[model samples]
Target: MVDFEKEAIIENLSKVINTKLTEKANKFVTADVREFGFIGDGLVSDTAAVQKALDYCESLGGGEVIFPKKQKVKLSKAGYRSIWTWNTKTKLNRAYALLIPSNVTVNFNECELIANNEGADVINLIENKNASVDLTKDSNIEIKNVTINQSIDIDTFAYNSMDSCAVCFQNIDGLVLDNVKVLNTYGYGMRIIKASNIEFRNKIQIDKCLGCNIRLGWQTFIVDKVNINLLVCSDSSNRLTANAVQGNTLHMNACSDFVIKEFRQTTSNPNKYVGSVNINNNCSNVYLGKVYSIDTGFKIQDYSSDGSNQPYNIVIEDMYTEGILDRPLFYIMGEGTKINNLRCKNIGHFWINNGKYTQFGRAILEKSSFVVKGNLPKEVHFDKLYLYNSSAAFQSNGGQDVVTIKDLTIKWDETTNTGSYLKLLDIQCKFMNIGSIVHKLEGSMKDGGNQKGGILSCSTENTLTKIGNIIDQNGVKTENVVVTLSTGMSTMINLAASNIWRDSWLNVLDVELVPVDLTSSIVIYNSFIADTNGQSLKINHSKAKGMEQFRLIVKGYKHIKE
Candidate 1:
């Protein structure tokens, strides 16, 4: 191994670059489309002529092939078998601007190609796999300043999930497309599969795309290092009237290390039931900077059945939604796709739809607002759920265990006008709510000692500090929690006679148990209620046997035997 001086190396490298540039300038010649009998009339078939020019430029070891401005290089409408074909090696599709061969730059400045008639992508990239080993740095394909309009549909590939688009790239490393506008695409605007280091920048806009706007990684490819900045996902007059396209307007499947800086969804095209931003199938290391949408919010889900494919290590910093979504604006489904580790900040609006969030690792939600559409999921768990000023009307479905919340805020939804499910903190500590504050114990608390009833049986499994701390950390206590029971049942927090021999501390100062639409009662442990204003604790509604005497003095309120 020999060390070279830095200055000497730079000088030699400069010399080499100058030589290469000089050689390329002399050898890489450019050709106009008209040089090969090309007629600009839209009626004539300019496929052969265009193909000749491109092949000629490529044969000269890669060069620029410029087309006349605003020329209608339309496909021959008469006696045509296929408008475009996958010309991977033999110059890519013989027609249209589909496959961009290696070391070639086609500038369609102010030019447009009317494609998407037959499920063939307007500009598709099928990399020369036989090139070099490393596709990341070895590939070279750039398409700039072009406008692609794909309006045709192939009946054969109509329902194919990953078929037809404005531009599709497959395993093409080192590809850069700038200032590209995709319009009137029947299917997706663009799709890249098994590719690496592919970038589409400088205001890439997609309009009137019937299907998905942008898609990455299909069935069996792991896409990496993709960046799409200044993206716009819009449709014209809700073109997806027949439900041909579904899921997210922008879909990311099994992709990694990608960033979508700014996405603007101008018009709200619900397409009835499609989500605006959908990321699923084990996508990792993704960051969405800012998103403004009126349609639907972002949904991160894993449709895999075996828990093998789920979203991991993802972040969405700032998101703003303009309209009130009946659905959850930001949601995470952990059915098959496990949420390993994720963090998102500043959500506009949200609601929980009652899904079993079976998370394997940790999840942190900070500075996000949870709009209480209704009740959140029944069995939901988070390592740390920190709500700064979020309005969350949530409760435990008797299945929560050891949850920790740090400084949260709650409010009412002005839309529903129907007040929230108020009564909450109804958690189950291993079938025992030991020393817990019981607001709306479903059935009567089984005389306290009777473990067989619907009452929350006190368990001595935990210490006094732990139980007290857990109840204090409940989202309600810090900001005034009122547990309003649901109507239709007469419940109780029964402090039966059997509790006379045991020591179970109720971790509440003023437990307000009121029903939503009915009047229920809780028979306290005789000394349950002490005073009215200085408000001593009270346990006075229900009763059991062998309660002879009860004496208690708390907060200067004294009570005699009952």
Candidate 2:
């Protein structure tokens, strides 16, 4: 019941369609250097000829530019030394290396743009003096599978002697770089300035560069799957002062909504590398993940000097650091910067210098926050915090907006010989929440060693509320531990507690503690007290109520007969 003539016609039409598709695929252009008047062997430095081939492909509306396998295309001085000075009008023709106009696609696979000189650079993209590429007012550009072996000394180029940036993209949109590797650059590896919707991919190694690895300026950029390797070395014998690498491994300035992932920095020297990553100067909407520093850590500062509505909406999570020295894992000077999840081990110091504007900043240290304070902030917030071998864990001078200390673990190693565990002076924060504590104080009393212990402070105009368990595993007697609460010009001092200990000294003066103000009550149940000389709970100006429920159990105590 089939139409045999119709079936034969359909079969013949299918064969003809298949033949035409094959012909189109075979006719597609594949650029080779030899086809474009490249006569010498592949080892010869024929970058001009190679660029000419690339330009021809671009003129024909974009295609793949292929290189011979296992062969090198050495870039000569004429090809690599081209510099586009800023503020000057320059015309790049199709005769050069594929002048990528707006909305053009240039793909390079199995090709290598190697440096002619063993130590020289391979590609140079200079910004004109007018601060724009002047790409005939075009925006869409894309590049892939390209390798740029940057020059080691870019100062020799007079046009771009001031700031040598390897790959500079300005005033462009929808630019994508994938599977690209840039090595041995004298200046910054890659710079994306004033660009929008830019995406770059894996293996960005800025090894032994004179400047920072990357710089982001005034652009909403998102960097995904980034692996940054910054190795900066210096020899003292050569009278070389190891200048701390200026700029950050990844620096953000005046930009917004920036997300960086898998950021890692490995350096041999600590002092030489300053600030693994810096977020400052009114940059907002930032997200960081898996930030690891092998030898040197990071510093996050807020530079809102003009008071331009301090940067907000910042999150740093899953941070792992090791072998750090004289640097803080997290430093927040901006307002409302939150650190949710962190894991740090074998670090030198962690500091939060809120500068003069201490009343507006907020920091949440969770999962073990440790530090030794050379200079402290006026106010701070700590939750689930831990300290080890650190001289002073909580040190603040007062005038804080808020201070919350919860679930603290302090361990004094035998190596640390100076300062106490906690120190607070003239604090004027609105609320102070302290809960759950374990203090292990160990030292010899031979040479003024036991003079320093835990929770040594002078405070005023703040609430002192304590709840939950307190365990003291110290070898010596717990003495000289004082908590003084007084009032400043403004707010009254409030104190409330339940089931608390008196093993340390507690002095409350010039304050009021009411039940209504203590709705979120501090409940302490079944505790022990072992104060040797100091009073357990000293109430001077006892105007307010709420301290009648504390039960103190004392053991092995010899009180001096008054």
Candidate 3:
């Protein structure tokens, strides 16, 4: 067995990187596009010249294909066509400017490629014809420091041709994208599918992509290890008029073992349907380090059937979101997920549904709430949760085994206008242990709405002493507690009737007497347990002293649920 946390998975992934592609492109034979009849005068069509140069490099068994850095490369859609056929007999005719071969490096050398409106993708990755469709994976391909402008007028572009992109990678291995900037793409900026061992380095900037800025493996094969650094997604208009659009900053499906160091989504007006970072289908083992989102949030869900391919083992650290007041900041529905250090400005919710061993630790939500829904597994823990000026709403469906919170704190700085902040609804758990709660809200906690069964043990300071029936230290469903009562001659302490299993019996563990206003030494013999029942305890004094205050202590046990 391999320990993924202890071992350097990035280093092991680096071992599979094809460094020989760069070595051969830089240190070996090279073919400049100008030498192969490419005139960079910005008037003639350079598509044929670039293709000839690529063919010349492939003939040399793998070499460098370079364009001039001083001049601009203009590719026109003359007669080059690529056809993609679907299972439903739908054909898509795309005009790709150039086709790249394997075992070669194309260095634009910071030169920009101005593509025409009909040119779908600036460079072709996979061959999609009728009889000669290429499903074979391309090896050792690297494109670096290139800027591409599809120059598609979004108003006139065909909506059925939404598959257009700046670069598309399908069935490829060992690819690297360095300092790639794509502007005003009609469709996706980059579409990656069935590709492995890829590295997106330096800065990847995509502006005004009507579709998702970067799309990976949507209804396609499984992808692996797509590590990115310093990603930036922005829309110039801040809105899109396309009716059919995947309006997400980054959407991934069926991808695994990926790490994104940093991501920034600057679109002020994002679509309401999708999230900023949408991880759908069966993506697992993903680590998102830091995210700064505006007007959007994050979502992780598994759309598989019969629980066969549920996503698991995901982690997100240090997330800051704003302008998402109607939806939750983190909408999670998977197992073994952890979110830490979440700080949000406006009020939102954190929704958790149908998961096991999930944790939300060390979160400072100023005006946000936590909501638990649907059926959950046995072990779900929330540790170090702090809420300020927000409601604590935990809603459960039914029949949850256990949910534990280590340290829960709720505080308010205002002195007025505080309503019911703690609302627990329909919580049916066997053992829900919330350890050490400090609540400073104004009103009392609303009663648990229609709880079915089980115990909720919460230690509090001022607002509420207990939320549900108390469970003792030895895993017993006992309401045995020590409370201080000040009464005159006799007082009745009502026992919570929620201890339904042991309602027929009662026991007095110990008794202590303490006088408040008298100088006389009050002893235990002076007081006596006048009467006791399954629902109440009555303690009385032997002497007929009118309105004399004294203290009482008691303890007991009940049946334990196995």
**Per-candidate TM-score against the hidden true structure:** 0.58, 0.64, 0.72
**How well is each residue in 1-562 modelled by candidate 1, as lDDT tens digits?**
1121323323443454334323332245677878988776666656567667767877787877788888765643221212212222333221234345566666776676654233333333222322222244324566778777665432223443333455766665556777888766645677666666666668888776556777777545667766667788765332343655553467788787666677776444454433467777767666565666654566666676544565655544455554433333666643222333444344555544333333223433443455222122233334333333223334333333233232222222222211333222222232211122212222222133222222112233222222221222212333222332222222222222212111123443333333223123332433243232322233444442322222221211111112
Candidate number achieving the greatest lDDT relative to the actual structure: 3
Native-structure RMSD, model 3: 8.4
Give model 2 RMSD, 1 decimal.
Answer: 14.0
Alpha-carbon runs more than 4 Å astray in model 3: 1-8, 17-27, 39-44, 78-92, 119-134, 153-158, 236-244, 270-275, 324-329, 347-349, 376-379, 399-401, 413-431, 442-562
True-structure RMSD, every candidate? 13.6, 14.0, 8.4
Candidate 1: where are CA atoms >4 Å away?
Answer: 1-29, 37-45, 70-73, 76-97, 116-138, 152-162, 236-244, 266-275, 324-329, 334-403, 413-416, 419-506, 509-535, 538-562
| Per-residue lDDT over 336-392 for candidate 3, one digit per residue giving the tens place of the 0 to 100 score | 677777776554656665655566677776666566666544356667766665545
lDDT (Cα, tens digit) per residue for candidate 2, span 432-508: 54555566755531235654444433234344533344556653332222223233211121112322333333332
lDDT, candidate 1, at 378: 30
Clashing pairs in 3: none
